[model samples]
Target: MSEGNGPTEGQDKVQSSAPPNAVWPLRDKEGNVTVPFAYGTIAFWQGKRAQEYQTHKWHVYVRGANNEDLTPLIERVIFQLHPSFNNPTRVIDTAPFHVCELGWGEFEITIRIFFHDGPEQGLEIKHMLKLFPRVGEPSQKKPVVSERHDEFVFNAPNEGLLQRIGMCNTRMPNGGPAWATIEPFFSPLNEHEELLRIQAAQRRVQAEITLVKEELENEEQILSFLQDEVKKLEPSIVKKPPGT
Candidate 1:
C-alpha cells in the first residue's frame, strides 16, 4: 500500500487519453496504471441485537468493481462512533473493515480507512446513523440506507501494492497477485458464511460415517450365516465319512 496522506482532488482527475495530471496509478495484474476506483459503502442503522439502552449500528464496506467484498483489505479503520459510548472513537486494525459498534443515540459517523498495503492511500468517509424510520415510510428491505460509491487514487504506490489493487498485477513477490496480502480480509470471511460451511461439512461427515456403519453390519450378518452353514456341512460330512 502507498504510505502518505490522502490525495488532493486535482490529483485524481484525468482529462485526456493519457493520464497527464499528478495522479499515478497503482499496478494491478494488467499493467502500469494511472487512476483506479474501488467501490465503498458507508451505512448505519438502529441496533439489530436490541440493547436496553438505544444504540446505533454502523459499517463501512469496500469492494472491487466486480462486487467482490474488499472489507478485508483494510489494515485499520478509525471509527468516530458516537460521543456516548465508552471510547467512542474506536480504531479497528484487522480483516473485515465493516465495523460493528454501538452508541446511545444517532449521529454522523466519520470513518478513516487505512489499507494494509497502501498506507499512504488512506481514505476518509462519512455516514449518518438513523435510529428511526419516518412515519408512513414504505418498508425497505436493506438494513443500511446511507451507502456510497467512491473512487480512490494512489500516487506512486509500492510495487507490492500495485499488484493487489488493479484489475491485473501478476508479478507479485510470492508468485501470486500482489493483492494476496489483503485477500484474506474480504468480507466473505465473516462468521455467518463460515459457520454455514462448517455445519455443512459436519453433516457430510456424519452421513458418511452412518453409511459405513450400516454396510459393516450387513457384512457381519453375512459372515455369521456363512459360518453356520459351514458348521452344518461339517456335521453332515462326519455322518457320511464311514462309507461315502
Candidate 2:
C-alpha cells in the first residue's frame, strides 16, 4: 500500500496458488509445512546516471519474491526493461537485479524469477517505468521516483518447492535441506534491503507531492482572501474620470 508490504494500494493480493500433491512451502514448529510468503518489488531512479550519455538515465531494480536474494537462491532473474532498449531482456545472476540505461521514455518492465531445476514453477512480476519531469522539461526538482511492492502466497506447493523454501530459510538439517545446502547456496542477506532503498527514494517523491499540494492550497486561500477584500471595497474607489 502507501508504505507497506506487497499488493500496492490499488491492487490487492498480487498472487496466490494451489496444486494437488502440493504441501505448504515453509515449515514451523511441530513439523508442519507452512505457507510461504514471497515479496516482490520494483523500483526506479531517474537522472543522469552516465556522464557521457546524451539522453536521460533511468535505473530499475527488482527484488525477488519472498525477499529471498536470488543471487544465491535462484538460477537467474530476467528483466525485460523496454522495447527501446537494445537487447532489452537480460539474465541476471548477481547481487542486484538493477539495470541502468539512457532514455527519455518509460515503459513496463516484465520480470521473471526462476529457480534452478528445483521443480518449482517460476514467478513473474511487472512494473511500469517512470521518469521525473517528463520529457523536454526542466529538471529543477528532485527526480520523480516510484516503488511498488507485491507478494505471492505459495499454497499447496510441490514437495521439491517445500524443500527449496526450507533450504532458503535455514530449516535444513546437517548440510541443509536434503535437496539443497545452507552455506553459499542461499544468500546471506535478505532482498528486503533493496526494497527499503526503493521505498526511501519513493518517499522523496511523496514528500514533494505533499509540499506542492500544500503550496497550492495556500495560494488558493490567498486568492480567496483577496477576492473577499475586493468585494468589501466601493466600486467608486478605483473608478476613473470620464477623460484623463
Candidate 3:
C-alpha cells in the first residue's frame, strides 16, 4: 500500500505544481514569428523596444505627363494599413482641404508628412491616404518584390518648425542615391500674391514720377504766357514799345 501511495503522491505533486513542458504555440521555437515582405508597404521597426515588431502601410500616388493637374489621382488615393502595423502607423485625415478630381499624366504621390511631436510621443504623420482607391494587391509569398521606395531626406541648417512643415527633399537611404534639392509645398496663390505686390509697388512709383513731371511743365507754360502778356501791355501803355 505504501508503494501504491508513493506513485499517487508523485502524481498529485506534479498536478499541483506548474507543468514543466508547457509552451506557447503562437511563438516559434526561438520565440519569433516569421513575417513575409511585400510592396506598397513601408517596413519599419522601433529601435528601443526589446520585443521585436514590424509595421507596414500601403503606398499611394498621383501621376501626370509633363506639368499638368494630376490631383485627380490624389483625390482617389487609398490607405490600407497592415493589422500588425496599424497601432504604430499614422493615419491621415482629409477634412480640411478641398480635393479636386482632375488627373494629369504626370505622376505625384502623396505621403503622410511625419513630424516629431515630443520625447514621449513617436513621430506623427497626417494620414491622407483614404481618398484614393487601392492600387496593387499585397503579395503573400516569400522573396518579396522590391517596390520603388521614394524617400525624402532633409539637410536643413536654420529652418524653423513652420518652415519645415512643407519642405521636402528626395533622398535614398543607405547611401544608394545622391541627395536631391529641397522642395517647397507652396501653392500658386502664394507665388501670385508676391508677384502682384511687387508689380503694384512699381506702378505706384512710376505714376508719382509722371505726375511731378507734368506739374513742372504746366508751371513753365504759365510763366511763359504771363511774360508775353506783360510785353504786349507795355507797348499799349507807353505808345513807344514797337520802336523800343
Candidate 4:
C-alpha cells in the first residue's frame, strides 16, 4: 500500500533560527523535517472500445499525503515518461504536480523531487504505470487508482526551511485542531483507517498459518499409521523358497 524513503541530510549551514518551542508536525527534537508524500496514477476508461492507439485517459501525480500542499518544501517535481511519447520529460514547479496523457500501455515512470534548500541532489523514485484492472476484477465507472505513500526525511535542516515548516498550518479533518499536533502528515481518522487495514491483513495471515499447521499434523498421523501397519504385516507376508 505504501513505501518510505531513507533520511537525507540537509545543508549544515544555518540560514537563520526559529523559536525552539514552535510546534510542527514531523519535526523531531533534532530539527529534522519529515514530509509525507504520495505518487500514483488515476485512469479513466474512454468508452468500451479502444480509440485508435489510445484506450484510456490518465494522469500521474505527486502530492502531499491527505492532499496537503507541498509548495513550501519542494522546489519542483520532474516526471520522466516513456520515450514513445513526445517530450517525455515533464516538469511541474507548483503544488499540483501532475502530468496528463492518453495511452493504451504501461511503463515505468521515474519521478524526481527537488527541495528548496541546498541539498544539491534530488530524491528519485520509480513507479509502475498501471492501465488495466487486476485479474478477475470487474471494471466500473470509477477511475482506477494506483498509489504509493512515502516520506522524505531531511536531517538537520537549515533555519529558512524550519520557518517555512512552522508557517504551514496543517488542519485536521472534522475541525479537530487548528494546528497539526499529533504525529506526521495524516489526520487521526486516516491513521486509524490505515491501522485497521494492517490489522485485518495480519489476522488473515495468522489464520492461514494455523490452518496449514493443522493440515500438516493430520498428514503426519496418517503416515505414521501406514508405517505401523506395514510393520505388523512384515512377518505374515508369504515368503517364497529360494529353490522355487
TM-score of each model, paired residue for residue: 0.42, 0.43, 0.21, 0.60
Model 3 Cα shift for residue 51 (angstroms): 49
**Model 1: per-residue Cα lDDT over 1-244, one tens digit each:** 1011211111222221111222233344545343322333322333355454533333334333223333434567787755665565768564334444443345677888777478665888776665455554323233434433334555666766664554232111221221332233223223355457668989999999999999999999999999999988986674546656
Say which candidate scores most in lDDT.
4
- Superposed by TM-score, candidate 2 places the C-alpha of residue 100 at a distance from the truth, in angstroms, of 1.8
Candidate 2 clashing pairs, residues 3+ apart or interchain: 38-66, 39-66
Poorest 10 consecutive residues of model 2 by lDDT?
Answer: 1-10
Q: 64 in model 4: Cα distance from truth in Å?
A: 1.2
- The superposed Cα distance between candidate 3 and the true structure at residue 170, in angstroms, equals 16
C-alpha lDDT (0 to 100) for residue 210 of candidate 3: 100
Model 3, position 19: C-alpha lDDT score: 15
Q: Residue by residue across 1-244, what tens digits does model 4's lDDT show?
A: 1011111222222221111221355764786787666788876666667555566666677765655556777789999988877677888786556677777778889999888873779899998888777864426465576777666788887888766655444422221121111112222225466568768989999999999999999999999999999999999999999999
The TM-score measured for candidate 2 stands at: 0.43
How well does model 3 score by local distance difference test?
0.27
- Cα miss at 238, model 3 (Å)? 3.7
Q: Is candidate 3 or candidate 4 better by lDDT?
A: 4
Q: What CA RMSD would you report for each candidate?
A: 19.2, 17.1, 27.0, 12.6
Better of 2 and 3 by lDDT: 2
Predicted model with the maximum TM-score: 4
Candidate lDDT scores, in order, read 0.47, 0.48, 0.27, 0.64
Model 4 lDDT-worst window of ten: 1-10
